[model samples]
Target: MASLSSLLPAPTQQVWDRDDERKAKRVGSALVVSQTSVPPYGQRKGWVPRAEEDFGDGGAFPEIHVAQYPLGMGARGKESTSNALAIIYSKLTDLLPSEVLAEDDPTLQKPDDEDIQDITEKTKLALEKLTNAKISAAMPVKAAPKAVS
Candidate 1:
């Protein structure tokens, strides 16, 4: 089977989950939080001349970069994405029972109703909140008063 990348003009392969390379190793900011304005930039008269050496680029809190799968591609791409999203949906969102997820049951095939992974991103987020996944932590809210006080 051909990967989605093969069809592209310039195909590229992605290597996911290299936390060791991306995370900060020995940055000052990683150890200590320092908010310094270094002579307030514009004040030329009394500029306290100082050299600050920051070895690390604050990789401890690296910005997340995600590449989402194309929705309306083709059967091959759809199958791949469906499999991926199905796993996440089943595991994270608790759509399937623990037994099913653990491969204890033989009902792992895609359901006939709909492709579980073929839903919109919005629905996925909602599902995450519903399952109380760490990625989509739901805030606590008090119930509204039913009648007037």
Candidate 2:
């Protein structure tokens, strides 16, 4: 019988220093983001009100998944977030009637679709400025200082 480690596609690359100061600072930053982005997402910055109602808004659900990781904070934060989200998606998939999951907990699926040629951005910075993305922001311009002659 093969060991559990053998099941993973590849061992996680240890590109980060576990005791780095930046990592600790970023963890705090992540927690701050999580506190805002979860539960009441209505008041988040730039969050536009939608016509349709959202799920779990009644506070019926006890808890929801939020990013708070001891490892993989700043530099690789997106990767960690993506990985955690994928796992949650897998569980949701498993619950669906039509979906077929090989492994219940972590179903290994291709991050990219085989048929499409879409490029997946691993980092948030690249995604923030993706070619087809449209974003706009403008601060109020103070009226040109009153001209006194």
Candidate 3:
């Protein structure tokens, strides 16, 4: 059996401390985004609606209802609050070594039949398990208020 170290490639890169610091500074400045959202009720600049609280509204929360690609929060801080951590979890697992990555966690598992039906079924099942309801049934169905005569 081959030892794990033998399978790995030796690092060939040199550390450039100064260059790394400069790159960090440049990237930090470039990606400097204000991650905090507005409080549910208040007035301030760049204050969008309090997304954290509003997402919990009983009237079918959009974040909970819709299936977003990359699932979790769009930005960094939002991940924990979004209830979309599964997406991030999946991504992280994908970056792990094959030996450890072969676990049976549904999130880390791949599906067979790379077709629309299979994808749809898997997505529906995942959403059902997560939300504890049939995906379609979980959605708010509109019944036109008897045409206000």
Candidate 4:
């Protein structure tokens, strides 16, 4: 069987180091805020702004700005928090692998439609299962006492 690297395309004519340098610079400045305190229950109707910060100066490079906020307290809040964390995790992990494998050759072709479809179907089924479990958990259950034998 061919090794994984053997399947990849030859490195492009562009300088790999230059691309790595750019990625390093951008990732070095990337900021991720986590573990922020949630607002009191029903204190605010929806997402509440907690803090905001700006970085970099008005120079050759544009400044970067970020706003920090926590979801409200309840089911909606929990879902929002979960989505926010997922996004942050995806962004961070997306950068991590590239940084480690910056020198690796790029794939010659995009993923086939069948592969994408298969993944989508699997994801949908998994989500359906999770939703079913959550629904079952939320439902009230009755317990029957056993009579003496």
What tens digits encode model 3's per-residue C-alpha lDDT throughout 3-111? 9989999869976699889988887795666565434433443433334443343232333334332433454555355454554545866778666564778876666
Query: What's the alpha carbon RMSD for model 3?
Result: 29.6
lDDT of 2 by residue, 14-119 (tens): 5677679787887777444422233364444444322113222432222334422223234342644446445354487677779556763443755447423345
Q: List the residue pairs that clash in candidate 1.
A: none
Q: Write model 1 residue lDDT over 1-149, tens digit each, in one string.
A: 89887876763776565675556444423667576543332443544323232112222111223321222234233444446444355355477455326554557665554555556656987786656554233443453323222
**Alpha-carbon local distance difference test for all models:** 0.44, 0.45, 0.55, 0.54
lDDT of 2 at 79: 45
Best by lDDT: 3
Q: Whose TM-score is greatest here? A: 4
Candidate 1 regions exceeding 4 Å error are 4-20, 24-29, 33-36, 50-149
- Score every model by TM-score: 0.17, 0.12, 0.14, 0.25
Q: How much is 21 displaced in model 4, in angstroms?
A: 55
Worst 10 residues of 1 by lDDT: 53-62
Q: Rank the candidates by lDDT, best first.
A: 3, 4, 2, 1
TM-score ranking from best to worst?
4, 1, 3, 2
Which of the two candidates, 2 or 3, achieves a greater lDDT against the reference?
3
Model 2 clash count equals 0
- Regions more than 4 Å wrong, model 2: 1-106, 112-135, 139-149
